[model samples]
Target: MLNPKWESIIRFKCPDGEVHYGEPTADLKSARVWTGLDVWSLQPTDTTRHVAEILAPYEPTTIIGIGCNYKGHAHETGIPLPNHPIIFRKLPSSITSPTSLVELHGGDVDYENELCFITSQPARNVLQDNALNYILGFTVGNDISSRYWQRKDTSGGQACYAKSFDGFCPIGPKIVSAKALQNFQSLRITTRRDGEVVQNSNTSDMLFGVRQLMAFLTRGTTLPAGTLVLTGTPPGVGSYQTPPRFIKAGEVLECEIEGIGKIQTEFTEVNSKAA
Candidate 1:
């Protein structure tokens, strides 16, 4: 297992146009990406640059999203708590930068703010007691979806299809090491739409905590290094609203996780005529 003592690790482009990994400065306005180093052997150089030069940490090999892992979220969706963890895969092609514009394909677009973690090593049939050992760090992610395709387009519901659109998964800003957080279960997660708080809840509300989810997911499966896992969203998703509120073009969505960081994304309409 790869564990680092750094407060946060970031992947960014320097003024010289080279990407590197390093910890963020105190105020988080800038970062210093490591030189000639990998996650397992990170060494920061004497260089700090503005946050604008940073990119979306790294390109993950696999992206997994947990469904209805929170009780309140399941209630809001009128779905019963799942006996076992529900997992869905998001294509690597769907990933975009932390501050990039999400092209909204005409449909019921929705936002799900979630706590995401990345693996530091390959894990197969990991036990709950040793699950955290495999995690490198945690970050915030927005699981953008199309409700129409998620629930109505297929015979049942095609979650992967509905959420695998281009630029659907926006994660980052930075990855806070697991060692930096005292209690992973007690952190607060909040989501905002147009500066209005739409979702507010704590990580303690998760039906299956991080440990259980990790152990269950790794059963008979190998989660390779740099694999990202989204822990699911809290209540207050737009699809659950009384009037069913979906994200509109030009709207800004922000996801913040206590002890981690915040990532904001803007929604833009895709011109079908140009497609």
Candidate 2:
């Protein structure tokens, strides 16, 4: 097994205005730049600098999402627990930095706080017991959604199209290596909107855990290295609220996981002409 001992891996802009991928130092305020290296080709280097801004670690080859994978989330949506993971594809273009602005296209824009993992190596027909070996690390992600397009439009109810808007997925502040987590199933996940905690749950409640998801997804498909997987959200999504609470322009949404860091995103309305 290739277990990495990194506290956190990130892509950041240094004070000199150049972007580089690096691992943060013990203080978590400064980073050691991996000069002339891509994230996958990273090697230990002594060059370090103060971070000016944090960016999304890297562009994933593909972004996969699990829907209604939590019991409470299925109940909230009035859908029964799935016999298998409800898989969906999120376009890589929808990805944005942790603190980026998520533009809404006028309808019920909702938030789904999820635990995400990145693949360390290509996997095909991977077994559950060996799935962890293929994992690089984990991070926090928000599966920003547009309910109208998800449920009422011509392409309604299709998760791929409904959740494929620009900036619909905001993930990362950093990636905590898989070796860093003692127990992946025990971590707590929470989502807050405008400072109010809206979703709170534990990974133990996931109907299908990480190992199962990995095995299932790679059955006959090749999961390329650097693939990102959003392991579903828990209950308390806005569309299921009593009066239906939706994300509006200028609102802030925070998605956090106990072991991994949090990702905060600000919502903005998409201009009519731009839409």
Using lDDT as the measure, which candidate wins?
2
Pairs with backbone N, CA or C atoms under 3 Å apart (clashes), candidate 1: 21-33, 21-34, 22-33
Question: The CA-based lDDT of model 1 is what?
Answer: 0.86
Model 1 TM-score (2 dp): 0.94
Model 1 Cα lDDT, one tens digit per residue, 1-275: 47775678877776678777878876666776566556667766777677656568778869999999999999988888999999999999888778888888638999999999899899999999988889998888899998888986452588998898988998888888888875889999999999999999999999999999899989999989889999999999999999999999889999999888788999988967864
Residue 63 CA error for candidate 2 (Å)? 0.8
Our model 1 lands, by Cα RMSD against the true structure, at 1.7
Candidate closest to the true structure, highest TM-score:
2
Total clashing pairs in model 1 = 3
Cα lDDT tens digits for candidate 2, 93-140: 999999898888637889999999889888999999998899988888
Candidate 2: residue pairs that collide: 150-157
TM-score to true structure, per model: 0.94, 0.95
